[model samples]
Target: MDNINVSDPPARITTITSKKLSAKRAQTRIQAFLDDFENRNSTLKGGDKTVTVQLQKLNQALLDESQKRRKSAGEGR
Candidate 1:
């Protein structure tokens, strides 16, 4: 999904803006969010399996976005 540069997003929305985060930093942030979410919503169903699947999806998305950005930059040269 495209990132919206709106000043204020809806309260229910979770916006992840593009930033130059190192792999470690990204992992840390993702882990922190997952932990916080799990803690806040303890009764949530579908344990580790759900989280793993979501992480895999997120990793693939980041890789795809990176490749697209690289290709775009290369084409400009």
Candidate 2:
């Protein structure tokens, strides 16, 4: 039905806010760029920490967001 979006599989933008949308877009771009850079270089972990730093940053952001959501939920209930 309305929930079934065959065209855009995950329905990622269904309830996205402007700031979150921008963050998601930036994450996607950063991931793609990292993938391309790694593929091109093939030695991503030896002397360059670009990919590692990017991954750490993304992980930190996700962790922080999760913590914020959990704290808000606890406060509400």
- Per-model TM-score, in order, reads 0.43, 0.41
Index of the highest-lDDT prediction: 1
- Candidate 1 structure, TM-score to reference: 0.43
Worst 10 residues of 1 by lDDT: 40-49
Off by over 4 Å in 1: 1-48
Model 2 stretches astray by more than 4 angstroms: 1-45
| lDDT, candidate 2, 15-75, per-residue tens | 5554445444555666677677767767644677776677858955855676787789899
- Kindly report which residue pairs in candidate 2 clash with one another: none
Span of 10 residues, lowest total lDDT, candidate 2: 15-24
Counted clashes in each candidate structure: 0, 0
Reference-based lDDT, each prediction: 0.69, 0.67
After superposition on all C-alphas, the RMSD of every candidate to the true structure, in Å, is 11.2, 14.1
